[model samples]
Target: MPRSPGGLETLDPTRQRQFSESGYLVLPGFLPEPLRARLVPEVDHWVDEGLRARSIAACAAPEAGGPPPVLELELAAHGELLTHPPLLRTLTQLMGPSFVFHHLHSDRHAPGIAGKPWHHDCEPNDRGDPALRMIHALHYLGGLDEKVGSLAILPGSHRRSADKTALAHLGTGEVPGETVIDRLPAGSTVLLDSALFHTRRPAPDGPGGPRYFIDASYCQTGARWRPVKPYWRHMLARARELGLSDSRWPELFAERHFTEYTGTV
Candidate 1:
């Protein structure tokens, strides 16, 4: 793929072909220094706050609760990061002309924090057609390496079936034959198909060390968008307050779709 000048090279014909065949590609140091510096601190702050909140909640109701809430920052709140020039340009190239920020969130893997299961971001219930639903961006904040923990993805696995056992084994240091561990420097960003099988490793031990990264998933605007319940309610009220006519409700609420699932094993 031809690298873009003054930007991470747009996935060139060769690179695009590779991605089509392989299911994932890494664009190293995609975000420039200044924007990365500015965004990293904000993401770090949000993750820290989320961790603290999760700790308190766990203490208050240890047995009743499930996993800690993965901190999420809405792009609407982080406008500068969302509208960053180079990132946006790259996204446009990857996803084509029209796309929407379907989801934006960050994860902070503290020491001993359990690693994530291998899973595709979009499954049958939620993903649109694979051809139009192209890329997701994972931005690394803290320095990442094998020891500090990094993302693990299955190359060419996007077209395969979702494996429950494979998901369970990702963080257990038992990667499947197709897996690739992404080792990235701080400020580097990786773009991959959301349907690709992937997982995050737990934080390794060290003073002043933890794994922090942001996952931003996008889909072509032509895809249906689904907001969660609370957000949907908020969107309804916001629309009314803005004096939007009822006719526009469908468009306003168009992106919100819910997923159905069987009981966890």
Candidate 2:
């Protein structure tokens, strides 16, 4: 990724246009090493202690009137990544500065993990406005290589109006015109238009090692977007309590941008 002469992170118009047309942007070694270092252990702990499972269960049974003891954003390094300055600036260039966070998920995929079916992660906004955008920032703390599964994405797919599972029946099989991203340096991040069709394919030669992955999403303001987790209100409140967002991005964790939780979509 290109940086300013000063070595500061920068997003130029050309890259912005590419993201618009390709439905994704690949940032090689985007996160700083220190940040990655801190995030790795956190992911291990999140999974090893079964906190990740509990978080998922909270999403599944949100009506239980409770959430997990700790949210992903509440994790020190995870919160830092969520509001990382470069990420926020790049996002502002792509979708403007007024967007609200959708969700954050952290996981360490074990070797031999099964592939995920082809799908999109976009949650609909109640206004039925297609222009309202949502984007996912997929942080690969350990990077990607042959040892782990690669991500397959359909370029320009976000332009189409379709269900999140429109391509589910196809599973993780190859698709013509699809691009396979199998190699990246540690701390790399992939920014995807939330509506883009994508799939996770297992390592070509079988699993090798755990994949340290975390994904956070944000939606453009102006419409009330649906929430993926039933405990979304609590999630945002906690983010605010932890001061995860900066003064510039007050809406980053504001509850006003989301519609009432209607359970998992």
Candidate 3:
């Protein structure tokens, strides 16, 4: 696999090809120190202050609950991250110039947290068109190491049309041809085709630091994609009200790109 050299501020021909064929791209040191420095504290607050839990509650059962008091994007640094220039440019290069924000998630994975089963995170668009793309940006704030845990990804698996949980039976077990990415620098990021099969392997037994991970997804515009959060409309409205991207990205937070929230499946 070809790793981005220091900065993936822009994708070159080779990087584009890698993503097209491999279903993923590893961008080491993609975030600047200053931006990352600001994001760390926000993650701490999101988790420590119970905001993360509140956010999840609103999604799991929105009829009885309202939007969380604080959204991840509302956090100053998180909001900036949602519209990071390099990320948008790379997405535009890979999935075309038009795409809408699908969702954003932030978490602090404590040491010895349970490993996640192998699965994909792709959300279906109403048109049922597989060609329409959705990409997930996995940001490693403090980076990955033996102690922080690693990500396992099955290359080219996105090409297969299977349910997201099709691979869950394997748990986090290593597959014959999967790639184990355990070593990376702070501020590194891995972009995956949302349909790509991947897993979060827990940190090896030892004293490990909390892993600060934030992920945001974007879907190419053409068809309305299913909304994961019932309060997604409110989320987008707040984003527009706050002018996260100002007037530059007309379609970034537009409500037309999504189907009505159908509640969790």
The reply for model 1, stretches above 4 Å from the true place, is 1-9, 50-77, 123-128, 161-166, 169-171, 203-208, 232-265
Give the per-residue lDDT of model 1 (tens digit) for 1-265: 3455664546567777777777776766666677667766666666656663663454355456453443233322344454455566666666665655554555566666666777777633345445556467777765567556767777887776564355665454656566655477677777787778777666455433566666666666555544322233333344344433234123322334433223222
In candidate 1, what residue range of length 10 has the lowest lDDT sum? 244-253
Query: Which 10 residues in a row give candidate 2 its minimum summed lDDT?
Result: 1-10
Runs in model 3 lying further than 4 Å from the true structure: 1-8
TM-score per candidate: 0.69, 0.97, 0.95
Q: Which stretches of candidate 2 lie over 4 Å from their true place?
A: 5-8
* Clash count for each candidate, listed in order shown: 8, 0, 0
Sort all candidates by lDDT, best to worst. 2, 3, 1
Better of 2 and 3 by TM-score: 2
Model 1 scores a C-alpha lDDT of 0.57
Q: Which residue pairs clash in candidate 3?
A: none
